[model samples]
Target chain A: MSMLPRRVEFHEEGPREGFQMEKGTYPLDDRLALIDALAASGLRQVQCASFVSPRAVPQMADSPELFARLRKRPGTRYTGLWLNESGFERARACDNIDIDGKVVFYVTEPFSQRNNNCSVAENRERQLAWIDRYIALGIPFEQAYVVTAFGCNLGGPVPVSAVTDVVRWLVDACADRRIRFPAFYLADTMGWANPEEIKRRIGAVRELVPQARIGLHLHDTRGVGGANVYAAMQMGVDLFDSSVAGLGGCPFAGHKHGGAAGNICTEDMAFMCEEMGVDTGLDLEQLVEAARLAERIIGRPLNGRLMRSGTLAAMRC
Target chain B: MSMLPRRVEFHEEGPREGFQMEKGTYPLDDRLALIDALAASGLRQVQCASFVSPRAVPQMADSPELFARLRKRPGTRYTGLWLNESGFERARACDNIDIDGKVVFYVTEPFSQRNNNCSVAENRERQLAWIDRYIALGIPFEQAYVVTAFGCNLGGPVPVSAVTDVVRWLVDACADRRIRFPAFYLADTMGWANPEEIKRRIGAVRELVPQARIGLHLHDTRGVGGANVYAAMQMGVDLFDSSVAGLGGCPFAGHKHGGAAGNICTEDMAFMCEEMGVDTGLDLEQLVEAARLAERIIGRPLNGRLMRSGTLAAMRC
Candidate 1:
């Protein structure tokens, strides 16, 4: 058997997942520019924004407005995560020339309580209620994502049994023949995963949610993001969630505003995939340009070494 | 098979290897204090200093004097390394209680010429001559060390035959005399070794010199020091050379000093060994004290994160 992965797919996380927690006030024009650059790189899907309470996440205040302005590519799917009825309504009211009739919803219990001032039970009820709204609107459920399947900040180590129960909720949401099964995604909000961990939990996810398309959204805290991705990929995970110039972080992770501290740089991810004989479709040069643009917009170095040092090894003289 | 190594040992590398290449002048008293601090940590063996030409390694100019001043501790065999007859003679002249009949002659070849400013042939002639002198002075030859048996900077990937040839020269010097054969220590002078490289070369060494006690002295130039030590330890290597605070770097390698720059922290090695279940007989608290002392002497924090963070895991709760 080959040690290398056989195939690869890419996702651009810059617009929504990358800057959702960023304290720096980014203009919508700059956000659009970053998205345009990333979309130009040929990434198929993006975790665009969260339709959550603006008072809770002011950084995502203009989430709907920003999505309204994007000149999205034909094949690219923009996924906006929602938690409650109000946020889903706000996402549904957004004006877009070209858009799909699917909506993604996630229930981050420990985080929803902290960030949304609701109990875990309330958050779960609200998310299930939103799925009912999705069925009422006749939107397809195959495009929706149930994120943070791994664990949460306040609740540590999401047991595979817990995830198994959560997938049951998704399966029920698609019952009654109104919607297809919701797509699944695992989000490591606190970025604490080793390769063995990925193997254990992701292997469980594969067993439980075998038919659902899964994407892994990882944080690079503790220097294990890329290795975790490599592990997941080895276990047959095809889709990945990453930010250009290594964006995104938790507001409360203490010491350096999250960003997984040393996050998995997308350019580095591209390099890792290519080196391991996997194709990411996104060109390296384009990704580098996207990183440079994001860095200028974010007003800091992305803290990725491969971008600083050229990707290819220097030829021996 | 275990995903982690079946067995692993970490070599404390900060004091001996780190202090030797540093540019700042350290007083002999300070050097003694540093060595004492390192020894207090209970590290099995440290590669004290090379007794080569003072002009070539001016940093170790007072090695003989330092040997004289060492506060001898019982069961702690004070070891000294020599590169030639002149060095061994100088070391032998010292009548200190610390190293009366226990000084080990260390002469490495190939890259040894660049380090000692003498050809391999000249080094062999001198080493053979000094072995006789050591016998005459009644110093034990068991403490003697032949370094760089793996590969060299000046001469790449040293053939196994070259190390065997050097051992044969040692055999000829013995003249059928009965004494313990000198330990062979492989050195990564320029740090080009990978795990595979170490595994292959170590196999070759054990194949030829099965009876010779083998040790590894590695520098972390390419971030493989920990991996290499882990590999060697798994292969049954017990003896390794380390410095307190990870203070040294090969001047022949890249620049950028300080704890974060190059050398692997001695505490990291200590931590690795302990976690991997290998008993290195090291005192963690004492090593931390010693590491901080080494850092103060160098006017910089040495590369030991464990010292600052404390070796034990702190409770998040």
Candidate 2:
């Protein structure tokens, strides 16, 4: 359909992406309220909550209840990211079965292995085992989407050929499954990817998976994240993964500058899209309001500017 | 000469552009020593110090002595800026034929009114008067120029037509004098020009001032300074005015987000030049050392990245 309508996928990782990062516990409702607004912002897909254990991401202790209170939007899909067998089973048992018409699962390779006490192989195998459960429940099992596919910051710049290899590996691994060929997504797990790197690797991915969808999950750690989106778009990569108001990151990865930082904010993405003539059917004013809610949920100001200043044009009006 | 060089020339603004904005007065030796490092970095034309009154520019009170201490390079020309009639008088007395070489006079119209209590036309009248006197005194008045010719922040954006009109007015007012076509430079008095604007105005200036030596004076309030430099250089505008470690603007301007908080750092501009294969012939390590000295004089960390991060290839090595 016109190469899959230029759509924006809001990945609300605040539960897993945001809370796992904070030194303090964000009350459950604080996150739920934010998720409710995010869903209303016309975002199609969201990593609503993760099914990891409390000890690992103690801030996400209430993933089950967090899902229970979620106000599912029509045409929206909720993905419960799992790092291991237990997280998958826990996610399966959670109160919502339909997931408002869509379901998917994701895990980062080395991060999953280290965080969940399992190898990348073990994590993939366990996640594959849960696909049938999703299929049997009459739900769409969005192929096993992998995260941190770009490179780990701790490990250094990932080779472009290595990224292409990951896409082929995922596609081949799921070749026999009933689910569609698993899509490959790249995440700047530590916000390290700049414009040049984005172009080089995005080109590598296209070469490896010409028919498959490629999503970019960029972080604004170096201030090049937004610009990287523009660069990737120039290279014909459109689908991107974003968090609202930049409300989330892996706390253990590092701080914002030298340490781990938040992903490029959804509103900022929408703003960038608006500027570049890409349409995501989002209400920017409403989206900004949603971002403000997210900032309050985490009790910290966000890194995004579009939310704070709105568009420069809007301010003049 | 052929066209404005797309490769922007970066001017280190530490001693003149940076410190003139500093509220606290720096010692003559501290200022001179800081400039020594900048000089070694191969900046051919440095705004070494201002020839304004001590009451007006206390930080630059000893411009003459500061010039005396500078280790003059063969190709380098140290320019001590002058703001008004009184400044030109001071410029003649401070002209050190042996060390500083020549005396150049310039002033900002908007700032002269705001800071010096004179109208722009009045200031120009004063400049025309002084250019003749400098000629009469046999001091090379040919090197003198003006700033804030394009637009001003507090004065707001001037119509390009108006700017051209002013240039024609300034040029026509010079009676086509041999030195009448002194370098016509554009300044971002409040750091407001974007990349697109830089391209539009600077390109327009190239067309209008076809034979006048053109240069750019930028303040990096917005983060788009580097990109703007790329745009300006691509348009063939060669000469640029920058501050070492991005020291620039009125200190009061730094208190605002859109003020002249940062000047284009000479080191960063050099890096851009190196990447783009332009010949700047700057010694970056010495520039970094210059940045450090500027930081110490200001008693705060300077914000230019090149001064802190070593060579681009150096890290990869």
Residue-wise C-alpha lDDT for candidate 2, range B1-317, written one tens digit per residue: 11324444555556777788777877877877776777787777677777777876677777777766666777666676665557656765664422222222223455667754777667666667766766666665443334444345445445666556556766675666665566666776544455556667766766766877666776554344554565566567777778887787454643422233467667766665664467677887788778777887888655565554344454233
Off by over 4 Å in 2: A1-317, B1-8, B22-33, B40-42, B71-77, B95-158, B164-175, B178-185, B207-215, B236-239, B249-260, B265-280, B283-302, B305-315
lDDT of 2 by residue, A1-317 (tens): 01213544444454457666677887877877776677677766667777777887777788888888777778666667665558767887887523422222223445664554676666556555566566677666544344554555334445666566556666665576645754456777655455556667777877777877667777655344554565566566767777776766443443221233467677766765653346777777777777777776666545554554444343232
Q: Write the per-residue lDDT of candidate 1 for residues A81-124, one digit (tens) a residue.
A: 66556767787787652233443334455666676587655656
Q: How would the docking of model 1 be graded?
A: incorrect
The clash tally of candidate 2 reads: 18
Judge candidate 1 at residue A92 and give its lDDT: 76
Question: Which 10-residue span in candidate 2 chain B carries the lowest summed lDDT?
Answer: B97-106
lDDT of 1 at A182: 57
